[model samples]
Target: MISEKDFIAKSSTVTIDNGSFQWSAPSNIALVKYWGKRENTNSSNAISSEQIPANPSVSFTLNHCKTITKLAFAKKQDQSSFSFDLLFEGQPKEEFKPKIQKFLERIAVYCPYLKEYHFTIATENTFPHSSGIASSASGMAALAMNIMSLEKALYPEMTEDFFYQKASFLARLGSGSACRSVKGSVVVWGNNTSINGSSDLFGVEFPNTIHANFKNYQDTILLVDKGEKVVSSTVGHNLMHNHPFAEQRFEQAHQNLSKLKKVLENGDLQQFIQIVESEALTLHAMMMTSLPYFILMKPNTLEIINKIWKFRNETQTPVCFTLDAGANVHVLYPENVSETVLQFIQAELVGYCQNGNYICDQIGEGAINLSV
Candidate 1:
């Protein structure tokens, strides 16, 4: 655990040379989604910040769908202000500058070097941005890892877990789900009795011994729409504040999380499918029930979902579909049935995808430090 003093600015005597660092972090799909949050400063488990969640969430980290970010730090002659040049896909993204700047300011307390040096960051995503894929999760997680890489270079004594946990904490401040992206296979965020070492501050790897079937579970993302959503995820999360069913939904998520833990451990794919699909639907349901109701899923999204159900029922294939607040559908199945599933996707689901675009991704071993 990092102490409060670690977040304080250091004396001028402490310094590190300019360096370049790169990291590729995966995007995570929450099975038991984290939709609502509340301030918990009075509680003992409360983090230093006010953005911690009210309940825990579990997720599966994807392998191929990720963001690669390179941070080139340079000692600036002018230390009076934070300086950085941001680029996305080899082009300057002026609109994204404000958000990136705000994230740097928020994390500057812990990573004091951020203010001391100018950071030139170049980021690229494997999947399209603003689609169903969690670009924020991958993007923020990659940036957090880059920050931690610089810190570790300056302080070589930092342990591996400390670096990762701190990165996860920092990522959460940028995007809540990004915390879970730091851990691979399965990770749980938010404090819960079902998971040991789990906290509201940052996510922890799923403690239970996961079955082999789940270890290599596949998630083929069927992209129904490549365009941006009408309502941003930030807006969707905010609607939960006064949502009529917020309390009950939170309670239901907790219950599903508890049950899913057992399913994960026992390889109960049938029950797992039920819970995963329900959670995906419930996530959309929450958005629809909000004050200004809106729908993100398109007609093709439903068609693919129905096709998946039909194929699964006819073949008894342990396959299911989940969504990520967008028009895309995530076709989940075990690797053993990958042949049949991939064929099904090509034959039926491909027609529904936008421009015949879809991503073939699976559970990966967390983020990669490409800097090394």
Candidate 2:
């Protein structure tokens, strides 16, 4: 396991220069969701700048639906301040600047070149933003990949494992789920007794124990609402501070992770469906039961879920659903059942999606280094 301390040692020696790098990184759907954070005790339970979760999480990296980011670094004419031009889909997204700037500031210490160079970042997503898929996870991970690629160019001696570990660590600092985007098929983030090499700072690949059947699983995202959520994930996570069921929910997640690991290794689809659906419902339940309650799931979200249950019961297609922080439904199933499951989605579940739009995606082979 590469700890945070071990990962930062190579950053200081890198020499900065004009460089351009691009990477396409997939977004992940957390099978075991990460909802709340463990706050800094010295800060009165206030949310720390660090995005460490209260419980561990595991996820599947999705294909077809991903973010492609290109970053160009140049020596800053004015060394006094860091500067950058950020764009989304060839348009300026002023709303996203602050977040990106803050992320850059957070990682400046680990990659000193960030402070010395001006950056121009252009990013685009295959799927619509705020439609339940994690854009931040893919976006930040892609950006982190570009950063690490630049460092790798500066220091050719860096190992492939070192590049990914540092990139995951940097991505975690940007978005909690982003850390898991670096690993393929399945990735586990946060410390848990069920998996070795898992860390609170980054994610570890869950390849060894995973059954062959799960390697090619499909995820068809039913976009119930294309619009942004009423409450952001950050705000939702913060509400856990006063949540009555927070502690119990954390304990439940730990137990579920252990059981789910067994199911994953044994290829138990029945148990997989149960645990995945339970985690999705539990995630929304936490939100609804918060002190200031909020509901991200729409009427159609439940409608689609109920219909999936009906189809699965009738056909025994071995399909299941999981959700992120939004209303969309991620219908997960083995690739062997993809044809049947996708037909079921189009025939029954498509009506629930806004404009009947859904993304056909599957477990991807991690990120692609377009720079090479």
Candidate 3:
């Protein structure tokens, strides 16, 4: 629930005398499938003849987030500043340090002006650490926005949108989805492009209130096992290139996006469930088709899916499940049914999902502007 204006206030207050700034940001989830790609990791269309299916899967993000990146400078003889640290869940992640270093280099490139200022970034998650949620996306987006806000305070020549674009672009360097959180509510990440120069790797605002206003959407994440990190999406995509179903799957995802769009437009619960189930299977299908046949789903994954199916059959309720390149399963339902939904999951689906935790959140607001 970190307001955009509040984030900006922090950055604007920093100065050579003060020499430090602190800021925080929130993360978001994709509603329609951002599955396949065209050029430069842009989200592609589903493969159906109509380009999308009867419904587009909807995703809602919550205000729950990570925060407070403090950037300060250790002026090297008043010229060069050196050293940095990146903390996830508060322990020094030396592994991500080099990546942080690269980030510093890139940021300096954007505003060669900020080259003089050294930085100390301290970020933590209010939400679960790495329970299949992309804390970094939310984290970096906040940092990027704050940095730009700082620059504006230090240099009024920069436009307000300057920092947002800079931060949005910079977030891409950290994680692709991070780009989406740059703007909140019904944002389409990666190329809301047209035949003209209308879109690129950025957020696109949705106009309809129906897709933007639905309040019952709930996603309950079940962490199956937070063990070995899954292959990075970059590596996974490379594998996808070699995958037999890669091309076809891309097509299917495009169609699914269309169907998902329809569902959002019409709020068709049944269609939403069907398309989500298929999209999840299709996403994993690409991995299964890889040369090594990496099956990303687990027994618990099936257990959840099965119960969902059984629940639907027994009670004729509309509930669905989806997977994203890991053992974790994201269960979808309306907000009002969360209690009953989670109850059934705990009783019937809990056995399959041992050694994991559950987190509940619904769709949330679009990116906000901090008035620092």
Candidate 4:
């Protein structure tokens, strides 16, 4: 049981030299979405419980859709505050700095070395902007990994387990889903009674044996609308505070996770598709029923989903769709049906995509240190 205080750094007289590190971290698609966060009762100590999820969520770590970040650090004379510059795709991204600055502030206590050096962070995503994939998850995870690399340089004795665990912990403070992006083909976040070693503070790889049918599952992302979402995930999460069905939705996530555990071990494609699709729809249903309701799905999103349903029913192909907090859809299926499912997507579903644009991705083994 790792507590928040355990993440805080102890006073050290270690001298740090300047170095650079590059890391690539993937974005994750949550089968069981983490829609809201647990409420913070202690206002003075809010940062400690900041990104804790309202319910446990599990996801598949993506391969092609990721963020590759290069972090260069140098010793600075002024140790008064943190210093850093951010670049996206070789250009200064001023708009992204504030978010990064806030994240640094949140984790400053955990990684105290941040204040001792100036950082130059350059990052770029594999997917295009407005692709409906959340970059924050990959971006933060990459940055956290680089920061951990720096910490490892300072303290040479850090174990690999502690290194990744602390990196996930720091990433969680940046974005809730970012923790899952740190590692694996499948990861579980938030504490659950059924899962051993699952923690609300960070993500853990699924402990049980996953059947061969689930290995290397495919996720073809259909870009329905290449435009900004009407509601941001942060705003949507906040809405759950006063939501009428908040408790029920949270409970449903827990129950679904338990059921999905069995489905994963037994290779039940039918039950897998059922639980996944239902969870996706239930996520949006919670939004629609909220106080200030808003629908993130577009008309073409529905068309694509209908096509998937029709094709799945007629062909008995194990294809299904899940959504993020946007109009785009993630078409998920097993690797065995790749050729048939992809052909179906091209013939039937591609027309609904924005300019016939979609990304073909699969399950991945999490972030990697490119510098190594």
Local distance difference test scores for all models: 0.86, 0.85, 0.59, 0.91
Per-residue C-alpha lDDT of model 2 across residues 1-372, encoded as one tens digit per residue: 444446554545656669799999999999999999875333222222388888999998888888999999898667766789998999999999999988977776677666678889999998777566668999999999999988887788989888898899889989999999986678998889878777787788984668878978898888888887799999999999889999999999899988989988999889999999999999999999998998998999999888988888888889989888888899999989888887788888899998888888889877898877
lDDT of 4 by residue, 1-372 (tens): 677777777766667668899999999999998999885443345677688799999999999999999999999999999999999999999999999999998998788889889999999999996776779999999999999998888888788898888999999999999999997789999888888889888999999999999999999999989888789999999999999999999999999999988898999999999999999999999999998999999999999989999999999999999998888899999999999999999999899988999999999999999997
By lDDT, the candidates rank as 4, 1, 2, 3
What tens-digit string does per-residue lDDT give for candidate 1 at 276-362? Answer: 999999999998899999999999999988998999889999999888878889889999999999999999889999889889999
Shift of residue 10 alpha carbon in model 4, Å: 1.5
Candidate 1 segments whose C-alpha is farther than 4 A from its true place: 1-14, 43-50, 130-132
| Best candidate, lDDT | 4
How many Å off is the CA of 309 in candidate 3? 1.2
Q: Which TM-score value belongs to model 3?
A: 0.79
Which ten contiguous residues of candidate 2 have the minimum total lDDT? 40-49
lDDT per residue for candidate 3 within 99-209, as digits (tens), equals 677655644544554555556666666665656666666777766766666567676766655456556666655655666566645555433222121133444445445
Position 198, candidate 2: lDDT: 75
Show model 4 residue runs off by greater than 4 Å: 40-44
Instruction: For each candidate in turn, give its C-alpha RMSD to the true structure in angstroms.
Output: 2.2, 2.5, 7.1, 1.3
Q: Give residue 230's lDDT in candidate 1 (0 to 100).
A: 89
Error of 4 at 363 (Å): 0.3
* Model 4 score (lDDT): 0.91
Q: 178 in model 4: Cα distance from truth in Å? A: 0.3
> What does the lDDT come to for candidate 1?
0.86
Write down the worst ten-residue block by lDDT for model 3: 46-55
